[model samples]
Structures are given as structure tokens and as C-alpha cells.
Target chain A: MAVATQDTAIRTGRFARALIYLVLLLFVLFYMLPLYVMLVNSVKPLSEITGGGMMALPQVWTLEPWAKAWSTAQIGVQPTGLRPYFWNSISMVVPAVAISTVLGALNGYVLTKWRFRGDTILFGLMLFACFIPFQIVLIPMAAVLGFLGLSGSTAGLVLVHVVYGVGFSTLYFRNYYAVFPTELVRAAQIDGAGFFQIFWRILVPSSGPIAVVCIIWQFTNIWNDFLFGASFASGDGAPMTVALNNLVQSSTGVKEYNVHFAGAILAALPTLLVYIVAGRYFVRGLMAGSVKG
Target chain B: MAANATPDFRTRLQTWLPKLVLSPSLAMVLVFVYGFIGFTVYVSFTNSRILPFVGPDGQPTHDLIGFTNYAKLFSLSHWEISLTNMAIFAGLYIVICTLIGLILAILLDQKIRGEGFLRPLYLYPMALSFIVTGTAWKWFLDPGIGLENIMQTWGWESFSFDWIKNRDFAIYTIVLAAVWQTSGFVMAMFLAGLRGIDNEILKAAQMDGASNWNLYRRIIIPQLRPAFLSAFVILAHLAIKTFDLVIAMTGGGPGRATELPATFMYSYTFSRNQMGIGASSAVIMLMTIAAIMIPYLYAELREKK
Candidate 1:
């Protein structure tokens, strides 16, 4: 009798586990539903989409929408398409990411290793910059850009991204270097190495993981930014997010849903790829960055 | 004697190099960050219209008109609606996200099958931009040709999911999209918190014949306070800065029903040429964010000390 009861308990336990998994699987589906819909609808021709079969797999698959989205779709009056904007985003992001990462590394090294009076206070001030709403600075930033004669230019956008981006980059590196061994710095210094020398040789070489985190974080943010891009850039200089917004919201002739989806996917492709490739580091970055949140 | 002089000079320079490298960042922050904030606050109090003008003498000028912009902002119906919408959006977004995130984290912590594939699948939306999410969900929620139409064709004849087109329901669609994009991130945060809990406590409770529900409710959930707080702070900030999502999804549309403060600020300052009022609204938003952030930062820094 005891054996039978034990068997029943085991059976119920297995059933309970299955139930938990089923719920989880349902959530996974819920999360993935939008992406599935995007891919399915994107590949289908307009005829099938309008046929009231949104979820059905495409019987006649074509790349025409993708092609048109890349080259022929009008973002505004310009039919040159998202191709230029894609490159525009790349140009802005690359320089912004590179310069900000290097500066953040230097700041982190100095703040952590070379402690001076009020250094923590200074670090705190920089950290505070990260959380301020971008709206507060929009009008003045525009004026600043205008004063510098960089209004409506990609370089202006780059400058905006780099300046705003420094806080986050510094936060990442500071936390990373705080727990890092100071013994190495002391040893290097005792060997007659100077500040930059110790940083470049000892600290920087060990910054592989945090560097990935910083670069990916900055790349995703700068690439995906719409507010700065929209405000600071205009025709021919707009980044992909702004361009995608215009393309999707543009009410011209027939709304090519396929083209819109393709354009959005293309615009999002890089960051999505980064997440897929290095998601572990991305999650680590978030944890480290927002641990005190 | 010459060698000693060289060493002394090198020591002084080395001490200053860290400061030298740090000074530029400090100066940029003072001007670009704090200075711009000061500029915005100053602009809010002035009667600047259309553009901030430069006088013929090449000095920028604005007429000082104190509290006029603030008064005007309170009287505007759109501003009232924007505040209402933010309350509704922020309230719902935070509650729903936290609940769903905690639940998902609990489920995932069960060490279910296919954890690896499931984790990233849930998190990939966070990788995509709000623009992409807004675009994708806009299509999904469109009544005529999206989910509603799809449901009708699936033989649910009375099925109607037209929230995207309904003004009253339109804001909810934004909530839907925002929740979808963010819940997984919250899950990751909670999951990290869950993993950090001491396993011996759980084992001890299990040995004492405590039920799973009791273990979670009595012990585990209480310990997730930090995670809960972090999630609230992050979500609240994201809720306030909800510009790109609303713009991409609805364009604050159906006759300004979904107009958020961020969108309002953009349109007023740049489009409508109401720079002073926009600046005022921007200042209000900064204050709101600062209210939450200042205390949070103080707690964090103090905890460290």
C-alpha cells in the first residue's frame, strides 16, 4: 500500500513538472509571437497578406519587399532608401562607440587606481549624468549644436551620442576596476612604470570581457537612438531609426506592410545579432550597470 | 643633481596626468550636462518663441517672463491628457511587468528543460529598438488587417481586437508593446536575484518538510526586495522617457490621445515653436526623474559606504 502511494506521488510530481513547462512554453510563444508574425508577414506578398491569412506561411515567397525596402522605398521625397541611413548609423555608431569606450576605460582606470580627494564625489557626479532625462537637454543641445555650426549633421549626432554615452561607459568601467586588484598597479608602478604605462600594459590587457560589454552596450544604444537622431539630424543625414520611423509612418500611396517590416528588421538586424552572439555579456552589463537600481 | 630634478618633475607630471585626462570629461559634463540643464531652466522662464533668437550684437536674447510658461502648461488640455496617460501607462506598465517578470523568473528557476533556448528567446525583444517593436506591434495590432482580421478569418466571426485603432484602447496597445519588450529584462534581473539566494536555506526548509509555496512566500519572495526595488526604479525611468515607443506606434495620434510629455516637448519646441513652454515641460520631467533618482542614488552610494 505504501509503495502504491509513493508511486502515485511520483506520478503527480512528474505531472506537476510538465505543467510548469507547459506554462513556460506558452510564455515563450507569447514572447516569440511578434517576431514570428513579422517574419511570416514580411516574406508574404501583398496578395496573401490581404487575403486575411496573416499567420499562414507564404505559398509564393519573394525578396521583392526586402529589395524595395533596401533601395526603392521613399523615406521622404528621397527614394535613395534606407541604404544611406544604414551607413549613416554605422558611421555615427562606430566613432561614438570607439571614442567613448577608450575614454571610459581611461576614466575607470584613473578613478579606481589613482584615488584623490573628492574622486568618489566626481565619480558620483558623472554617474548622475547617466539618469537625467534627455528631454531636459534637447533644446539646449540643439542650440549648442547650432552654435557649433553642426546642426543637421552626422558629426553633430556623433558628438551628442559620445557626450551622453560617457556616463554609462564610465559607470561600467568604474565598477569593473573597483574590484580589480590594485596589486598589479602597485607592482607595475614599483617597476618604474607611470600611470598610462600601467593602464595600457596591465589593466587594459585584462579588460577583454568588460570591453565587450561596454562596446555592445554603446553600439546598441547609439544605433537604436531616435530622439537625438531625429532632433539633430535631417534629410540625407538621418540615422536608420529616424529613417525607419519616417518610412513606417509615411502615408503616401498604398501602405506596403511588407516593406515596413523588412525595413524595421533591417534596421534592427545589427543589435539583434549582437544580442544573439553575445547575450551573456549583455546581461552581465545590465546587471553590473543597474545592480543598485 | 640633474637626475634628482628629472625624477621630481616626472613625479609631479604623473600625479597630474590622471587629473589631466579626467579634466576634459569633467569640463564637458559641467558645460554639456549641468550647464545645458541650467540653460533649459533659464529658457523655461523666458518668453522665447519659435527659436531662441540672437540679437544683432551676436548675443542670444530672450524676454524674462516668470511663471508664464508654467501657467500656460497647466492650462493646456494636451498637457493634462499627457499626464493622465503617463499615470495610466506607468502604473499599468510597472505592475504588469513586475508580476509577469517575477512569475517568469520563478518558472525559469525551476530548472526546466531547454532553459538555454528559452532564456534568449524571451530576451531578444529587448535587443531590438523600440522603433522596431513599435513597428512590428503596430502591424500586429491593426484591426482591419492584423490580429482582428486574422481572428475573423480563423472562424471566430465575432472576434474583435481593434485596440490599436480605438483611442481609448490605443494607449493600452502601447502598454502591450512596452510590456512585451521589457518583461524579459525584468525576468533576467529577478532571475539573477533568485540565483543569488543561499541554497542552504531552501534545503533546510525542505528538510523541515516545508511546502514549495511556503518556501517561496515565506522566504524567497521576501529576499527579492532589492530586485523588486531595482525593477521599479528602472521601469519607472523607462516609463517617463517613453518617447520613441509612442511615436513609433501611434505618433501620439487619434487626435493626440496618446501624446506623452516627451512627444509633447518635441512638437512644442521644434514643431509648434513653443520653446518656452517646451522647456518648462522638460524641466518638470527632469524634476520628476530626479525625485526618483536622487533618493535611489543616495541609498546606493550610502550602502556602499
Candidate 2:
């Protein structure tokens, strides 16, 4: 009787475990459904889509949509495709990410190691700046860009991103360095090392992980930004997101769903690539960004 | 004595160097964030519309007209619709994301197999831009050449899922797309929270013959309060700042059914040239965000010290 009861309990436990796995699998399907749909239909001809075969595998796979989206699609009366705008985003994101990360490293260095009166308060102010709605600054920012003669320019977008992005980067580095040992800095200082030397030789060498996190976060943000792009840049200077929006939303077109999907995937490729390559850091960045030190 | 003087000077420079390095960022924040906010606030109080009111001296002017723009903003039907849509969208989005996040986090914590593969699959959407997510879903949800068509072709005749086109239900489609994009992020947050929980307590509860349901309800769920709070604040803010997705998916369309404050502010300020009213609307958004953010930041900072 004891053995039979134990056997029955084991059987029930297996049944429950199966149920759990089934539910998890269902969610996996739900999550993958849209991506699968996009990938499948993006390769098919327009007829397959309009013929109610959206969920079906492509009868004829072709790279034509991808090619067209890259170099020949009409966006806002320009048949320049997403090629220029892709470069626009690249130009904007690279400098923005680089400058913001460096500034954040310096700010993080000072805020944590070189503690002084009212420094926390100052850091608090910068931190609060990160969360403010951009709508509040849109008018002033537009005016400032125009006054500075950077309106509708990639350089202007870079400046806007760096200004807004420095906060989170600062937060990440500050939190990372807060736990770093100050004794090493003191030793380096006693050995007659200068400020920049100590940073470059001692701190920066060990800052590899946090730097990756900061760079990835900043890259994703500046690359994907649409509001600033739409507000500040226009015409030939629009970034990929804005251009993709125009291509997809153009009311006069034949609703080229395959081309739109291809363009979206192209727009998404950089960040998605980064996420896949360094997803662990991406999650760390996301967690660090949210949960304050 | 000269050598001693050099060391002193070096020490003084070192003390100031950190501040010197920090000053530029400080200046940028002050001017760009705070100063610009001040400028926008002033604009809201002025009579500037389309362009800044110009004085006889051939310069832009700020002729203050107290509360007129705000009064006009409050009286607009478009503004009313945007606010109503925001409340509904935010409420449903937060609740659904939280529920789904908590459930997924708990389930994933059950020592399941293939955990590594499953987690990132859930989170890839967070990595994609809202525009990309919006584009994918817009077509996926379209009645023609989309889910409805596929369902009808699959012999589910009379099937209808045209919420994307219907004004009354269009807002829910936005909610669906949003929740899909963000629920994974919330799940990550809650999962982190779950992982951080003290396993000793869980072990102790299990030793006391607690059922799994009771263990979660009585102990595990309570421990996730901070995660819950963080998720709420983040989701609330994101919901308010939702412009890209709406613009991509619906363009606040079907006659402004999904009009949100962010979109509203953009169209009014940039397109309609209602600069003063737009500034006023932005100020309202800022106030709402501040009300949530200020307290959270204060508590987080205070607790640290």
C-alpha cells in the first residue's frame, strides 16, 4: 500500500509538470507569432498576401522586397530608399553613443569617488532629467536647433540624443563604480599619477562590462528614437525610423506589405543584432536603468 | 619651498578637476532640461501662436496672457478625447502587463527546462523599436491580408477582428500592441525580483508544509512589491509618452479614436501651429510625469543614504 501510494504521487507530479511545460510552450508560440508572420509573409509575392495566405509559407521566396526597400522605395517623394536614412541614423547614433558614454564615465567617476558637498543633490538633478517627458522641451529644442542653424541636420539630432542620453549612462557608470575600491585610486595618486592617468590606467581598464552596457543602451535608444527624429530632422535628413514611417504610411502607395515588412526588419536589424550578440548586457542595462542604486 | 608650492597647486587643481570635468554636463542639463522647461512654461503663459509674437523692435516677444491657453486647452474636444483615451489605455496596459509579467516570472522560476532559450524569446520584442513592433502588428491585425483573412480562409467563416478600424474599439488594438511589446520587459523585471528573493524563506515555507499556491500568495507575491512599484511607474510613463507606436499603427486615426497626449502635443505644436496651446498641453504632461517621478526618485535616493 505504501509503494502504491508513492507511485500514484509520482504519476500525478509528472502530469502537473507536463501541464507547466505545455503552458510555457503556448506562451512561446504567442510571443513568436508576430515575428514568424513577418518573416513568412515578407518573402512571398504580394498576391500570396492579398490572397489570404498571410499565415502560409511562401510559395516563391524572393529577395526583391529587401532590395527595393534598401535602394529604390519612395519615401516622401524621394526614391532614395532607406539607404541614406540608415546612414543618417548611423551617423547620429555613433557620436551620440560615444560622447554620452564618455561623459557618463567622467560624471560617474566624480560623483562616486570625488565626493563633495551638494554633489548628491547635483547628481539627483541630473537623474531626474532623464525621466522628464520630451514634449516639455520640444518647442524650445526646435527653436534652439533653428537658432543654432542645426535644424533638419544629423548633427542636431546627435546633440539632442547626447544631451538626453547622458543621464542613464551616468546612472549606469555611477552605480558600477560606486562598488569599485577607492584604495587603488589613493595608491595611484600617492605614486604621483595625475587625474586622467588614474582614470585611464586604473578605472577604465576594469570598466569593460559597464561600458558595454552603457554603449548598448545608448545605441539602442538613439538609434530607435522617432520623436526627436520627426521633430528635429526632415526631408533628406530623416533617420531610418522616420523614413520607414513615411514609406509605410504613404497613403498614395499600393500598400506594399512585403516591402514594408522588409523595411521594418532592416530598421530593426542593428539593435536586434546587438541584442542577440550581447543580450546578457542588454538585460543588465535594462535592469540597471530601472532599479536605481 | 618652490617644490612645496608646486605640490599645493597640484592638490588644488586635483580638487577642482573633478568638478571641472562634471561642469559641462551640469551646464547642459541646466540649460537643455531645466532652462528649456522654463522656456516652455513661459511660452504656455504667452499669446504666442503659430510663431512667437514679434514686438515692434523686430524681435520675438513673450507677451504674457495668464491662463488663457490653459483655459482654451481644457475646453477643446480633441484634448478631452486624448485624455480619455490615455486613461483607458494606461489602465488596461498597466494591469494586463503586470498580471502577465507576474505569472510568467513565477512560472519561469519553477525550475523548468530550456529556461535559457525561453527567456530571450520572451524579451526580443523589447529590443525592437516601437516602430518595428507597430509595423508588424499593424499588418498582422489588419482585416484584409491579415489575421481576419487568414481566419476566414481557415474555414472560420463570419470571423471578425476589425478593432483596428472601429473607433470605439481601436484604442484596445493599441493596448494589445503595447502590452505585447512591453509585457516581456515587465516579466524581466519581475523575474529579477523573484530571483532576488531569499531562498531561505521559501525553503522554510515549504518545510512548514505550505502548498505552492499558499507559498506564492502568502510570501512570494508580497516580496515583489518593489518590482510591482517599479513596473507601475515605468509602464505609466511609457503609456503617457506613447507616440511612435500610435503614429505607426493608426496615426491616431479612425477619426482620432486613439489620439494620445504625446501625438496631440506634436500635431498641435508642429502641424496645427497652436504653439501656446501645445506648450500648455506639454506642461500638463510634464506635471503628470513629475507627480509620479519626484516621489519615486526621492524615496530611492533617500533609502540609499
Candidate 3:
């Protein structure tokens, strides 16, 4: 009777494990479904998608949609496609990410290593900047950008992102450097190393991990940003997201679902690439940003 | 005398260098974030319309009208709809995301095979821009060419999933997409929390002959409070700031069914020529977010101290 009871217990455990795996597999499918649809539909001719074959793999795969989305698709009365806007996004994101990460690293260094009076209050002030809804500052920002002669320009968008992004970058580095041994900094100081020298030589070499975290975080954010891009820049200078939105939402002509999917993929590709390459750092940045650790 | 003077000057420079390095960011934050916030708050109480009334001296002409925009905004039916939609959306989005996230986390925490493969697949959505996710989901949920069509084609002829086009249910579709996007990140958070739990405690509980259900209910879930709180705060804030997804999916359509505060603020300030009213709405959104964030930040920061 004891032997039989053990056998039944083992059987039930196996059943539970199978159930767990099945549920997990279902969720995986659920998550991948949108992506699968986007990819499958983007390549098929417009006929296949409209013919109720969205779920079925295409009988004839073509890259015409991609080619059209890249160079000749209509985006708000302009046939320039998403290519220029893709470059616009690159220019904007590169400068914004670089500037913000450097500033954040410096700010984090000072806040942690060069602690002073009311520093916590100052850090708190910067940290809170990260969370405020951008709507509160829209009107003023528009006016300011106009005054600075930057309205409707990529540079204007870059400045706006940098200003906002510094808060997050600072948080990333401060948390990272907080646990960094201060003794090294002190020793460098004792050995007659100057401020910039100590930072460059002693601290920066070991800051690779946190720097990757900050850069990836900022890169994804500035690249994916639509609000600032839509609000601050327009015309030929609009970023990839804004341009993509225009392409997809433009009401004139037939609803080219294929081109829309291709355009959406083009917009998503850069950040998605960053994420795929550096996902571990990306997750660390997400946790660090959200959980305040 | 020269040596003494040089050393003193260097000391002073070193003392000031860090502040100098920090000053540019501080100045930018001050002028851009705080100063701009102050400017918006002032505008909310003014008679400023499409163009802010700038004086001849190149300053904002503050024709101070106290709370008039606030009154007008609160009285508008459109604003009321937006607020009501926000309440429903944020509530449902938060609750559903948390539940789904917790379940996924718990399931993944069981020593499963292919853990690495499943985790990244779950989280890839977070990497995509909301606009991208919005585009994908917009089509996937469309009735004519999407799920309903596919279902009907697959011989489920009675299937109907038109929530994206329905007036009352359009907002729920936003909630669905949002939960899809961020729930994975929440699961990661909870998994991190679970992994941090001491295994010896689990061993001790098992030694007491506790059932698996009781073990999770009484011990494991209780220790996940921090993860739960973080997920709630993050989701609440994300729900409030939801604009891109709504725009991409519905455009606040079916006659303004999904007009979130973010979208409302955009249309009023940028489109409807109601700067004062728009600023008022924005202030309220900020206040709502602050109510959630301030205490959380205070606790998190103070605990660190």
C-alpha cells in the first residue's frame, strides 16, 4: 500500500509539471503572435493579406513593400518615404544618447563620490524630472524652442530629449557608483590625480557595465520617443516614429497594410537591434530605472 | 609664497570643479524642467489662447485669470469622458497586468526547462516602441482583416472580436495592448524577487510537510510585496502616460471613446486652440501622477539613506 501511494504521488507530480509547461507554452505563443502576424503580413502581396490569409504563410514572398516603405511611400503628402526620417532619428538619437549618458555619468560621479551639502535634495530634484508627464511642459517647451530658433528641427528634438533624459541616466550611474569603492577614488586623490584624471583612469575603466546600461537605456528611449518628435519637429526633420505614424495614419489612397507593417518594422528595427544585442544590460537598465535599486 | 598661493588656488579649483561639471545639467533642468513647469502653471491660470500673449518686452503677458480655465475644463463633457475613460483604463490595466505578471512569474519560477528561451520571448515586446506594438496590434485586432476574419476562415463562423471599433469597448483594447507590452517586464521583476528568496526557508517549509499550494500562498507570495508595489507604481504611471498606443490603434476614435488625458492635452493645446484649458488638464495629470509617485520616491530614497 505504501509503494502504491509513492507511485501515485510521482504520477501526479509529472502531471503538474506537464500542465506548467503547457501554460508557459501558451503564453509564449500569445507574446509571439503579434510579431508573427507583422512579419508574415509584411512580406505578402497586398492581395494575400486582403484575401484573408493573414495567418497563413505567403505563397509568394516579396520585398516590394519594404522597398516602397524605404524610398517612395507617401508620408503626409511627401513621397520621401521613411529613409530621411530614419536618418533624422539616427542623428537625433546619437547625439541625445551620447550627451545624456556623459552627463549622467558625470552627475552620478559627483553625487556619489563628491558628496556635499544638500546633494541628496539636488539628486531628488533631478530624479523627479524623470517622472513628470511631458504634457506639463509642452507649451513652454514649444515657446522656448521657437525662441531658441529650434522649433520644427531635429536639433530642437535632440535638446529636448537630452534635457529630459539626463535624469534617468544620472539615476543609473548614481546607483551603480554608489556601491563602487570610494577608496580607489581617495587613493587616486592622494596620489595627486586631478578630478578628471581620476574619473577617466580609475573610475571609467570599471564603469563599462553601468555605461552600457545607461547607453542602451538612453538609446532605446530617444529612438522610440514619439511625443517630443511629434511636438518639436515636423516636415522633413521628423523622427522615424512620427514619420511612421504619418505613413500609417494618412487617410488618402488605399490602406496598404503591407507597407504599414514594413514601415513599422523599419521604425522598430534600431531599438530592437539594440535590445537583441544587449538585452541583459537592457533588462538591468529597466529594473534599475523602475525599481529604484 | 608662490608655492602657497598656487596650492591654495588648486584646492579651490578642485573644490569647484565637481559643481562646475554638474552645473550644465542643473541649469538645463532648472530652466527646462522646473522653469517650464512654472511657466505652464502660470499659463493655466491665464487667458492665454492659441498663441500665448507675449508682451512687447518678449515676456509672457500674464493676464492672470484665476481658475477660470479649471472651471471651464471641469465643465466640459469631453474632459469628463476622458477622465472617466482614464479611470477605467488605468484601473483595469493595472489590475490585469499585475495578475497576469504574477502568474507568469510564478510559473516561470518553477524549475522549468527552456527557461532562457521563454523569458526573452516574453520580454521582446517591451523593446518595441509602443507605436510599433500599436501598429502590430492595431491590425491584429482589426475585425475585417485580423483575428475575427482569421477565426471565421478557420471555420469558427460565429466569432466576433470588434472591441477595437466598438465605442464602449475601445478603451479595453488599449488596456489589452498595454498589458501585453509591459506585463513581461513585471514578470521579470517578480522573478527577480522570487529568486532572491532564500532557498533554506523553502526547505524549512517543505520539511514541515506543507502542501505546495499552501507553501506558495502562505510563504512565497507574501515575500513578493516589493515586486508587487513596484509593478503597481510603474503600471499606474505607464497607464496614465498612454498616448502613442491609443493614437496608433484607435486615434481616440469611435467618437472619442479612448480619449486619455495625454491625448486630450495634445489636442487641446496643439489642435483645439485651448491652451489655458489644456494646461489645466496637464496640471491635473501631473498632480495625479505625483500623488502616486511622491510617497513612493520618498520611501525609496529615505530607505536608502
Candidate 4:
């Protein structure tokens, strides 16, 4: 009986180990396959790419496509090219995230520590704000943008993204604050620390995780944003997203796969770099944003 | 602390200062977000065409034609197709991403070397723009100059994968791209949940000689419900609102087979200049999300212990 039981135990251990390996191998393939295909095809000459299998290594790799994508695809001869839009994306997103996150911190501070008149109602309304789809606001937003003389500026796009972006950011900050012991706030108040004082000195400093979360969420939402960018900006004020559309979709022209791949790669570089550098914090940020809510 | 204490003027002002700081965000919430939604719903009821007109012109203008715009919306084949496409995309996207995410999460949850690197590989897709990702997918999925040609050259005479052009299967390509981009994030949710599970419970089950399947089915799955719920809700919301994936991958192409509500509204408002119809569609989209969400929220909130 002892011998049989020991044998079965050994078998189960081997099976479990094998199963784990198989699952991991399959998942990695699933995750990496498309990316591998993209990278392999991007470097290969059209002949090699089309004539060879997607999984095959590039036989005759060339850098010409990347150069063409940068110099010609959306980078026009007229000077106002992808560079302007690249800057536009950077300027709009950075400031929008900054402004929205700061305000979100303030809202979270107020909601958690300072109980004001109709405070619960205010919090409810803020919660309600997050759920509403932004499409409902396009016409009115256009009208408002027009009225404010912001219809064709990068700043206008920033303003709108911040407005929409704040809801989620606030939810992040507020929910994080909820996890923090209320005694911290009560103790701070007892120590004669005011709202802004306590928030800036104590809460904000310790809120590194939530802050990272806010930055990543806001950055992605704003940078990858197409609808708001398209609606708000055109010409020089356009972001990378709009430029990408123009580069990929020329209504009356032949499609350029080489340039399109180049543009696509160029477009994804920023967020990808951010992910590589600060991915763990970003995950923590998302977890806090999602799980609590 | 005195009940109903009449606070001093300085205390009152100091207390109100944070609210003052909050005014900027409040202003945004009031005018930009909610205001536009209200205005769009109003526009939907009007007889507006081409562009949004506030009042009647000698030509057809934005007049209060009641349910006429909605009447016309239901009659359009384009509208029906777009709605059908959205439903299909959302359903497939939510289900596939969750299933893949969960399966991957479980594998990574096991004690394994190199699991850390794999976690980032899965999550990296979440960081990319759909437009960029879409471009990559298109090239890889292209017939002559991409995967298919490459495959043909490798001596596989019968290897055809061209869903990008096939109207029926075009949207599935979009779903595949999206799942690639988003499943990793859901996997992170499950990873975090798995980390939080008490190790002692697993050891106790092991002592009881419980099989792995029994341990997972009876103990672990139930413990991970919150994590699953959160991941599912976020993924479901994203799927319903998917427009970037479609535009980036197929552009609702091969005959508008991949049209989503957001993209459809965009075309109506900008391309077709049918603001009335566009506004009407936006209202419907908003209401549909709200309808689905409120019930989910109620159920979850009520169930909270």
C-alpha cells in the first residue's frame, strides 16, 4: 500500500509540473506570436516577407521602410508634419494628466477627510460622472469649444481630455484614500494640520502608488485618444493618433504597408517605453483602480 | 465636538477652501461632460440634418420632430448593421479576453522561474495604441505581403488566413487584436487576486489529500470571484465602447461589417454630417450602457457584505 501511494504521488507531481510547463509555453506563444510576426515582417523586404512564412526570420532586412515612414509617410514636405502632432500629443497629454491628477487628489482629499455639506451627494455625483459615456457630450463640447475660441488648438484638446480624464483619476485617488485608515486624517486634524497642508505634506507624498496609477491611466487615455483629438484638432494641432489615421488611410491613394508599419511602430514607442520602465507600478495602479471600484 | 456648533468665520472659510479648490473639476463636470450629453440628446429630437441647426430654416432644419429621427434610425439598414456589429464585437471580446486572461493568469500563478518576464510580455500590449497595434495586425494578416505569402513560400500550399477582407470574419480580426492588447491587464487582476489568497488554506486542502482539481474548483475559484468580477466588468465596458480597435484594424471595412456604435456615430456626425442621426445614436449608446450598468451596480452593491 505504501509503495503504491508513493508511486501515485510521484506520478501526480510529474503531471502537475508538465501541465504547468505546457500552460506557460502555450500562453507565451499566444502573447508573443503576433508581436513576433509584426517585427519579422517589418524588417524584411516585401519579396522576402510575402514569399516567406510569417514565423520565418527576415532573409534580406532593410531599414528603408523605417526611414521612409519617418521622412515621408506623415512627415510632409510642407513642414507641419508628424513632428507637430507628436509635440501636440506630448504637450496635451502631459498637462492634462498633471492638471487632472492634481484636481483628483484634491477631490479625494476633500471627500475622505473633510465632510462638507451635501458631501455624500457630491461624491455620488462624482461617481455618476465616471459612468456617463463621453459621446453624449460631443455636440455641446464642440459648441463650447467654439465659444471658448478653442476649436483648433492643442490646448482645447487638453482641456477636454482633462475634464473626462478627471473622473477616473478621482476614482483612483478617492478609492485609494478609502483604503487608508481614517485615523490618519482624524489624527492630522487633531494635530491642527489643515486640508491642503495635510494633503500636500502627508497624503500626497505617501500616494506614490496611486500617483503612478493616475499617470499611466491618464497618459494612455489621453495619448491614445483619437475621438477627442480628431474632433478638437486638425492640421498642426493634431496628435499622433490623427496623423496615424492619415498615414494609414489615404482615401484616394494606394496603401503603403512599409510606411504604415513604420508609423505604427513610431506611434506605440512612448507608451511601450513607459510600460517597460514603470510596468509594476502601472499594474498596481490598475489593480487599485479596478479592485476597489 | 459640539453638536450643531456654529463654527467661527475662519474655520468655516478654511473648511470651504478645499471645495473651492474642487470648483475647477466641478466646472468641467457641469459644462463639458454633462452639458454636452444633454445637448446631444436635445439635438437627437430635432429635425437637424447635414449640420446641427438650432431652429428651422427654409430648407429642412432642426425642428422638434419628436420621435421621427428615431423612427428613421430604426428604418436604416446601416443603423441595424452597426448595432448588430457592436453586439457581436462586445460579446466575443468580453468572453474571449476573460477566458484567455484567466487561463494565462493560472499558469503564471504557479511557482515558476521566468514568470516575471512573461508577466510583462503579456502586459506590454495594454500599453500600445490600438491604431499602432492595428497596423501591425494588418501587415501581419495581409494576404500578399504578410503572413499568408510568407506561409505559402514555406511549402504550405493550402494556408489561407485573410479575415481582414472577408466581411463576415473581418470583425473577428479586430477582436483578436483587442484580446491581444487587453487580456494581459485582466491577467494582472487575477495575478493580484491569486497573490492575496491564503497559502495555509491550500496546505490544509493538501493535507486532506484533495486533488488539484478539487482544490481549484472548490477553494480557489470561489476566493477569486471578486477579482474575476472586476476584470470582467472592466473588460466588458471596454468591449462595448470599442471603436479604436475597429478603426485601427479594418476601418469597419470590406463593406462596413465591423462598424461599432462609436465609429458609426463618428461617421454620421463628421463624415455624413447627419448630426441629428448621430446625436440620436449617441443617446441610444449612452442609455444602453447605463441600462446594463445600473443593474450590475445594484446587484453588486446589494450583495456587498
Report clash pairs, candidate 1.
Answer: A293-B230
RMSD in Å for candidate 1, one decimal?
A: 4.4
Query: In every candidate, what fraction of the native interface contacts is reproduced?
Result: 0.65, 0.69, 0.67, 0.57
Q: What is the C-alpha lDDT of each candidate?
A: 0.87, 0.89, 0.89, 0.75
List the candidate 1 regions with Cα displacement exceeding 4 Å: A1-12, B1-5, B57-61
Indicate the docking level reached by candidate 1. Answer: acceptable
Listed for every candidate in order, the interface RMSD values in angstroms are 6.9, 6.9, 6.8, 6.9
The digit string of per-residue lDDT tens for model 2 on A111-225 reads: 9888899988898899989999999999999888887899999999999998999999999999889899999989998999988899999999999999999999999988899
* Chain A TM-score, cand. 1: 0.94
Candidate 3: tens digits of C-alpha lDDT, residues B1-305: 99899999999999999999999999999989999889899899997886646877899766789999999999999999999999999999899888988999888877777787788889988889988989999998999999999899889999999999999899999998999999899898888877777777777877788787877798888998998999999988898899999999999988999999999999999899889999999999999999998898888988888
Tens-place lDDT digits, model 4, residues B1-305: 45445466558978778888888887778777667777788899986765435335545455787888889888988889998987788888888888887777777766666777778888888777787787778777778666667667777779897888888898888888888889888887776777767777887888888887887789887999988788777776677678777887778888888888888888888789788888899899888877756565556434531
lDDT of 2 at B45: 96
lDDT, candidate 2, B1-305, per-residue tens: 99899989988998899999999999999999999999999999987776535566998766789999999999999999999999999999999999998988777777777877888898888888889889999999999978899999999999999999999999999999999988988988888778777777777877888877788889988998999999999999899999999999999988999999999999999999889999999999999999998898889878876
- Fnat, model 3, is 0.67
What TM-score does candidate 3 reach? Answer: 0.97
- The candidates, ranked best first by DockQ, are 2, 3, 1, 4
Model 3 interface DockQ? 0.46
User: Chain A alone, TM-score for each of the models?
Assistant: 0.94, 0.94, 0.95, 0.86
Where's the lowest-lDDT run of ten residues in candidate 1 chain B? B49-58
Query: Comparing candidate 2 with candidate 4, which one achieves the higher TM-score?
Result: 2
Model 4 accuracy (lDDT, Cα): 0.75
